[model samples]
Target: MYCNHCGANQPDHAVFCSQCGAKLQTQSESTVPSEQEIDKEQTPVDYLDQLRSDQSSNHTDSEPTLPIANKPIHRAEPASSTVSVPPSGSPPYRSTSPARHLTWIIPTVLLLGIAGTLFWWYQHQQDINVQVTQLHQEASQLALKGQYEPALAKITQATTLRPTYAVLTKDQTMIETANRIHTKLETVSSNLKQNQLQPAEKSLITLQKALDTRKESIFEQEKTLANRNQDLLAVLKVKKELDQLDTIDALAYKLDEVDRLNNQEAKEVHQLIINKIITISMKNAEKLLQQNDFSQATAAVKAGLQYSSKDEKLLSLQKRITSEKEAFELAEKQRIERAIQQAEEEDLKNRTAGVELLNVDTQLNEYGDIEIYGEVKNVATKPIYSITVYYSGYDAAGNYLFSSSASVEPYDLEPGATGSYSAYEYDWYEEVTVQIDNITWYLE
Candidate 1:
C-alpha cells in the first residue's frame, strides 16, 4: 500500500504511515464489493449496534475522530490484541488525496506555461528585429532617391517598433535636418527665379548657418545645391550688369567672373558677354575705320580680340583695317613723290632766271640792331608766288651767332626783275658776317 500523505510504500496492515508517522485509516470491509457483507447500506440502528459492539470490545486511549463534512464516520481504537488480516490476495490499501496529486500537476503546468511564455517572448523580439531591419532598408532606399519624407516615415515606423535604438534616433534627426535644408533650398531656388534677392539671400544664409551648426551630416546634394545657388546669384548679378551696359569694355570686364562659375547658365552668359563685346568692338572699330582713325580702329579690334581671338567678324574687320591702312600709306607716298618731282621739273625748266645778291650789306644800326640788306633777282622765267631769302649770321670768328629771314618787296617777280630786302637782328653780336644759307619760293 502507498502511504496516503507521502506516497511511500507500506505494508497492507500498517496502522500508521511509516514515512510521516501519521495515523493511517483502514479500508471499510463493506465499502469493498463482496459477497459476504450483505448489509452494504447500513441503517442507523446497525451503525449504532456496530459502534456499541466496538465500544464493548475495546478500552482505548485514542482521541475520538471528528466527522467529515455531512458524513458520519466510525472511529476505531488502537488495538492491543492481534489484528485480523484480510485475504492474502486482497489489494493493499493505496488511497491518495486529490490535493496530493495536484502538487505535481500544478507545478508541471506552471513550468510548461513559463517555458511557453519565454519562447514566445524570444520569437516576438526576433520578429521586431526583422521588422526594424526591413524598415531601415526601405528608409535607406528612399533616402537615396531624395525622398526624405517617405524615408523619414519609414524610420519613424522603425523607431516606434524599436524605440531604444540610439542609431535609429540619430538617423531620424539627420534625415529631418536634411529634409529641412532641402525644403529651404527649394525656397531659395524659387526666390531666385522670382528675382526676390533679399528673400533668396536670407534663405541661403539660414541654410548655410544650419549646415555649419548642425552636428549631423548633411547630404551631398544639399550642399551642392547651396553652393550652386550662391554662384547662380552672383552670375545673375553679373549678367544683369552686363545687359545694362553697351560697351565692350564693361562687358568684357565681367568675362572672368562669368567663366569662374563654369556652369550651364554661366556658360550661356559667357557666350553672350563675348558676343556683346565682339559686336560692340566690331561696330566701334568699323566707325573708327570709316573716320580713317586707323589707330583707334586697331585699338578697338585689339580689345575685341582679347575676348574672342577666333571671332570671324573681328578677324575680318582686322584684315580690312590692315589692307586699308596699307593702301592709304602707299597712296600718300605716291602723291608726295609726284609733288616733289613736279616741283623739281619746274625748277629745272626755269633755271635760266638766276638769283643775284647785288649791293648786299650787313652792319650795326645806331639803335643797336644788326641790319642785313640785299637785292634779290628772280633768275627764273616763271613768276614765283612768294620768295624769301633765308640767311645765317656769324660772328667775326666765324661762329654762328644768329639767324635772319626777309621777304622781298613786290611778292611776285618777273624774270630778271630786282627786289630789295632788309632784315634786322635784335640780339647784339660783335662784328656779324651775314651768309645767305637757303632761299624758298613757291611755284603755283
Candidate 2:
C-alpha cells in the first residue's frame, strides 16, 4: 500500500509508514473505522510521550526505533484533518493539533499573568511606604511649628496608609504629646490673663517640660509669666505698705516705689495706687473741711486732681471745697462788718460822754509774748456798745517799739459799768503805755 502521509509505497501489512513516520492507512480505516479501531491507536498523551522519548534518544545516541505493531495501521479520522504529519525521514513528529498547542499557550499565559500581578503588587507597596514616610515628615515639621491639630491629621493619614503597629504607635504618641503641650499652653495663657498666678505657673512648668525652651517665642512666654508673678508680688508688698501708712505723704511715697514695674498687670497696679491716692486725698480734704481749714482742704483736693483730672470723687471734693470756702468767707465778712459798726457807735458814745482807762499794765507771758491789760469805766448817760484801748510798746530807754489796740469785753456797758481790756503783743518789750483811744456805744 502507499503511505497515506507521504504517498510512499509500503508493505500492505505495515502498521507505521517508514518514510514519513506516520501510521499507514488500512482498508478498514479508509472506509470508516469503528470505535474499537480508533481506540487501538495511541492516545495524544502517548503520542507526546513518544515524541519526548524520541527527542531524548536523538541527542544521546543513534535514534531509537519505534515499536512497530504487527496489526495493519489505520488512517486518521476526518475530524483530525488539521493535523499534519512530519516529512519522510524526519525525527519522531510531535503532535501539531490546535488543541495540543492550546495546552502550552494556556500555561504560558497563566504563568506570565501571575508574574505581572506580583510585580504590580510590589510597586504598590513601595508607593505606600513612600507616602507614609512623607506623611511622617510633614507631621514632624508641623508639630515643631506648634500646629498640633494639623500635625495630628498628618499622623493619622500615615497610620491609615500603613496600619502596622509601628505606624499606629508612632502616630498615637506624636499626636498625644503635641496635643497635650498645646492644651497646656492655652491653659497657661488663660490663667495669666485672669491673674491666677499659681495655676499659671504650674501649667507653664508642665508646658516647659514638653517644649523646647530654646525657641524664642517659648522662652519669651516663660519669662513673661515669671515676671508677671514677680510684679504681682511686688504690688502686694506695696499694698501692705500702703495699708500701714497713715499719712498721704507716706502713701504717695509707697506708690512711687512700685513704678518700676511696667507690664500690663503692673499698669493695673499703678492705676490702683492712683485710685487709693485719690481716695486718701479726698478723705483728708473732707476732714480739713470739717475743721474749716479751707486753704489746706483745697490743697489736698487739688493735689489729688493733679493725678487724675477726670476722677469724679476728686471733682466732687473740689466742688465742696469751693462752696465751703466761699461760705466761710461771706460769714467772716459779715462778722467783721458788725464788729466795726459797733466800734464806731462806741466811739461816738465815748466822745459824747467820757471814757477812760482806769489802769494800764504790761508783762511777759511764758510764750515770750507781752500782755498789756487794763480796765475802763463807762461814764456815758446810756450804755456803751464797745470800747478800744490803744497801747504802745517801748524799750527800757522809752523808745517806741510798736503800737496796737484791744477791745473791751461786755461791749454793752451800762452807765457806771466797768469792763476789763486786755491785749497781747508778740514781742520782748520792757514797757507799754495804755490809753482809751476809741469807744463803741449803742442803745439797746
On lDDT, the leading prediction is: 1
Q: Write down the TM-score for model 2.
A: 0.41
User: Can you give the lDDT of residue 245 in candidate 2?
Assistant: 72
lDDT per residue as tens, model 2, 1-444: 666445567786799977656687675565233455455645422344454554454443443333442234454344542333444333322343334345457777999999999999999999998998888889877766667688888888888878774965655575666566556666666766565667776665555554554343423444444455556656655765666676667766766767887666567767877888898898889999999999999999888877788999889888888998999899989989988887777666656655656787878877778888888887765666757666667776767778778888877688788989888888563445443445444454
In model 1, the runs with Cα more than 4 Å from the true position are: 1-101, 163-167, 244-253, 291-296, 342-444
Residue 321 of model 2, lDDT score: 87
Q: Which residue window of length 10 is worst by lDDT in model 1?
A: 38-47
Q: Count clashes in each candidate, considering only residues at least 3 apart in sequence or on different chains.
A: 3, 9
Instruction: Assess each prediction's global lDDT (C-alpha) against the native.
Output: 0.76, 0.68
Candidate 2 Cα misplacement greater than 4 A, ranges: 1-111, 126-275, 306-308, 334-444
- List TM-scores for all candidates, in order: 0.57, 0.41
The residue pairs found clashing in candidate 2 are 345-441, 346-439, 346-440, 346-441, 347-439, 347-440, 385-411, 385-441, 386-440
- How far residue 381's Cα lies from its native spot in candidate 1, in Å, is 17
> 1-444 in candidate 1: lDDT tens per residue?
655456476687888777666565455532333433433424213334454444434433453322332365555453432234446445544324344455457787999999999999999999999999999889877876679999999999999999999989988888887898899899888888887777888788878876776544347678778889988887778877876889876786788888888578888889989999998998899999998899999999999999899988889999999999999889989998998897687577565234656666889877777888888877675776477788998877889987768998878877778888888887584568889876766554
